[model samples]
Target: MTTASSVSRGRSGWGSTAVAVLLVAVMLFPVYWMLNVSLQPGGGGAVASPWLPLHPDVSGYAKALRDQGPHLLTSLVVSLGSVVVSLVLATPAAYALAQFRLRFTDAFLLGILVSQMVPGIVVANALYGVYSDLGLLNSLPGLVLADSSTGIPFAVLVLRAFMATVPGEVVEAARVDGAGELRTFWSVVVPMSRNALVTAGLFTFLFTWSDFLFALTLTTTDDVRPVTLGLYQYIGSYVQDWSAVMATAVLASLPAVVLLLVAQKYVAAGATAGALK
Candidate 1:
């Protein structure tokens, strides 16, 4: 009945909401600024862009599409290829690590964890010599393989966590029906773990899509450039078209943003399902 303590709690709750909103606004400000700049006429000509795009323009986007279209396609191919490779390799590995009592399983998992701690530059340098020897430099296949290095490990961990929670009795029941391990996995486990697969696949796509390091390291030609590395066109001693740069960035960000928004439910389900494991 409007007690003093209830009133105080209500005010505190609103205070927390206000603070959260403020924090979100602060973090999202740069994204808003990027959008504003992308819409401005010629990026407002070296002056700070105004808070809003009172006069929106599309020329920058047109130019960006003209110049970066191939790069965007290349990135799409590489990111999709990396997702396929990562899932194909990681799913079995994760299943084995999750279910099998193999020797060195824990040690192998530890090794994978340690691999994540290694610096990307070190891995890139190591791959550089190998790729040069193998004549893989500037090749799309080389970039796909290189980007999958990051995707595989992460996919394995996520998939393993979810697979670990899969009921052993379900697998056993499949075996009782004369289903081979591979068949059982495909027929039973895969369908049940769709959320985890989506989660892993989307993340792999994001990783490979944004992978500037591998693209820069493995590619030396314009023929196979991904959009992340192609962003270099906007930067140089002679560059002055900030609008083009911002437009390119905005375009580059679209796929990941769209994927996250679309698959957010699957991602959340996969994450919470894996928590106990």
Candidate 2:
């Protein structure tokens, strides 16, 4: 009976593994196709074979490099700046909401939720006039601030949930040691919530990096263009450059791919641990 049960369990585990593998393949099909198209010879994405790149060409990548390199750097700068701003503002606000129990905490959180519900286009339209007046249009700082709108509320929600799980006794112990609230938060709470902070920062980076709407509306000239807009411009009104477009897309996707691979463990932990209690 023991041997029979062992054999059954082994079969079940193998079956589950097969299902997981199939699911991953299904999810990765688009990425595989993008790579395939990028590697094809300059035929505007119309390759003779779909399965493999029989004639790989590097000219597309060369063109993309020449055209989109500055845009990619601009994206990196804005994304990093947005992450910094979001974390700086959200960390303290999240801690307050998690620990302070102020009378308007619920209202404040509700406001955040409402902000998320507002459409991105609406926000962009509203900010355009403000940015024009402030002379922030077509600038990196303007893009950073606009992108932070996408990150800050989500970070606050995630960080607050995780921060709430921090042991009350631990915080009390730090206070008893004569640590002021700010010092305690900086030294103890921040260290304890490192995983959540990393996870929040990762998401913030991705959000800002992938942002196209704000980049489109906020920047008027090529002086401050991001990779997303640069990629969009590859398809002109008369003709489309599919090879260069796909190459640029692949290059743009690299940061997100690398980030997920590097910080996936922290992401999973934060998602599980930050479950609303």
- The candidate that wins on TM-score is 1
**What lDDT does model 1 reach?**
0.89
Residue 251 miss distance in model 2 (angstroms)? 0.5
**Which 10 consecutive positions of candidate 1 have the poorest summed lDDT?**
233-242
The residue-level lDDT of candidate 2 at 132 comes to: 98
Tens-digit per-residue lDDT, 208-232, candidate 2: 9989999999999999998988888
User: Which stretches of candidate 2 lie above 4 Å from their native place?
Assistant: 1-20, 47-50, 237-240
Candidate-wise lDDT, in order? 0.89, 0.89
Residue 17 of model 1 has an lDDT of 100
Let me know the TM-score candidate 1 reaches against the reference structure: 0.96
TM-scores for all predictions: 0.96, 0.91
lDDT of 2 at 187: 98
Error of 2 at 145 (Å): 0.2
